[model samples]
Target chain A: AQTVTQSQPEMSVQEAETVTLSCTYDTSESDYYLFWYKQPPSRQMILVIRQEAYKQQNATENRFSVNFQKAAKSFSLKISDSQLGDAAMYFCAYTNQAGTALIFGKGTTLSVSS
Target chain B: DVKVTQSSRYLVKRTGEKVFLECVQDMDHENMFWYRQDPGLGLRLIYFSYDVKMKEKGDIPEGYSVSREKKERFSLILESASTNQTSMYLCASRYAGTGTYEQYFGPGTRLTVT
Candidate 1:
């Protein structure tokens, strides 16, 4: 069974700064995908970024990027120049090569302080 | 732009009542999913459909059922609602193609079973 773990239950960051949320997963499969999703107070879950397990290069979308270390089973999310709008519950997810349903970690609630 | 819509933003139902939650997607997606989100538990998949009239059980499928009579619509049903079933229900859809690991989510329905 694949399992994802997000160590931080709650994270606090300042506006215009940077914050990193740690996530680790256990999986035996070689080919899979990792993702970060943000759920705001509006109850909308938005895709922040994703990383392909086979890709050596990390995936970055605007100010959000992932440090995907497949060897260590560590996939962390880095938010550079964090904004107040970044305050939300962020989730780490995994899916296999066949595009099965995502397995998510316990979310980390990010609080952005001005 | 992928648009996924849930029938309600909030729903309150009594215990033992039959509840139905509707989800519709406009992207012609081949897969639809139902997930329940709880604090410290993350998002647990309840059910999923790969195609119309096809359904599969997920990690926590107990006390829940699904119907997918049409390609773009998926419904989650609670045969006998319980207080433990009170949580945020999220609906998602994805394409069954390359680079389609990302699932688009709708604004969730917060179901409260009293």
Candidate 2:
């Protein structure tokens, strides 16, 4: 069984600043995928970024990036030039090569202050 | 663009009532999943299907059942809805592949049971 953990329950970032949300997971599978998802007030889940466990390089998507440390079992999400629209609940998820379901973290509430 | 649509955005039901949540995906995805989101519990997978008519139980499948008679449709059912089952339900789907693949999600259905 794989378990994702997001230690921070809530986080706040000033507008135009940068913020990092931490995530860690426990999985015995060598081949896997890591993902970050955002859910806004509309209750729609949106994919933020993704990282392949085999790739040593981190994944970046515009203002959203991931710091994936496979050895440490850590995958953190970083948001740069944060705006008010970035205020949402962020979740970290994991999926293995066995075609199994995704395991998700508790989530971190990001409050972007103006 | 891939679209996963839920039948309802909000629903209210009483305890012991049978509840059904429908989800349809237009991307011809091979995998469909149902999850429940709670305040601090993140998203817990209740059921998933890899192909039509094939269902698998996930982490929290105690009170939930699922049906996938068609490739594009997946349904989640609660035999006897309870107050504790009142939460946001999400539906997601992904293409079948060995490597990393992103899952597309639908706007969640918020179910309130009294």
Candidate 3:
């Protein structure tokens, strides 16, 4: 069984600054996928970024990127130029090679201050 | 754009009542999932369906059943609602294709069992 852990329960970042949310997972499988998701007060889950375990290079979206360290079993999310809209609960997830349902972390509530 | 919609945004039910939560997707995805989210716990998969009339149990399938009579609609049922079952229920769908591991989610339905 794979388990994702987000040690931080709450985080705050000033507007236009950068923030990093930590995540770690335990899995024996060599082929897998890691993902970051955001949930706002609307309760809608949105995809932030994704990283393939086989890929050595990290994945970057508009303002969201992931530091995926396969050897360390760590996958952290970095949000640059953070805005008020980035204030939400962030979750880290893992999926097996078979594309099964994802296992998610407890989540880190990010509060972007103006 | 993929769109998943839940039947309700909020629901209130009493103990022992039978509750049904409906989910529909417009993307014609082959896989649909139901998950529950709590404050300290991340999203836990309750049930998933790969195709019509085919369902699979997830990590936490107890006290929950699902129906997928049609390809676009999936429904979750609580045979006997309990206070412990009260949480934000989320529905998601994903297209199983080459390199597609991201799942699109709907605005969750917050269920309160009293």
lDDT of every predicted structure (CA atoms): 0.96, 0.94, 0.94
**Interface RMSD score of each model:** 0.9, 1.1, 1.0
Residue-level lDDT tens digits of model 3 in A1-114: 889999999999999999999999999999999999999977689999999898999999999988988989999999999999999999999999899799999999999999
- Minimum summed lDDT over a 10-residue window in model 2 chain B is located at B94-103
Q: Give DockQ for candidates 1 onward, in order.
A: 0.86, 0.85, 0.86
lDDT winner: 1
Query: Compared with the true structure, what per-residue lDDT tens digits does model 2 show for residues B11-102?
Result: 99999999999999999999999999999999999999999999999889998999999999999999999999999999999998765678
Model 2 preserves the real interface contacts to a fraction of 0.92
**After superposing candidate 1, which stretches have Cα over 4 Å from the reference?**
none
- A113: Cα error in model 2, Å: 0.6
lDDT of 3: 0.94
Q: What share of the true interface contacts does each candidate keep?
A: 0.89, 0.92, 0.89
TM-score of chain B of each: 0.98, 0.97, 0.98
Off by over 4 Å in 3: none
Candidate 3 lDDT for residue B84: 95
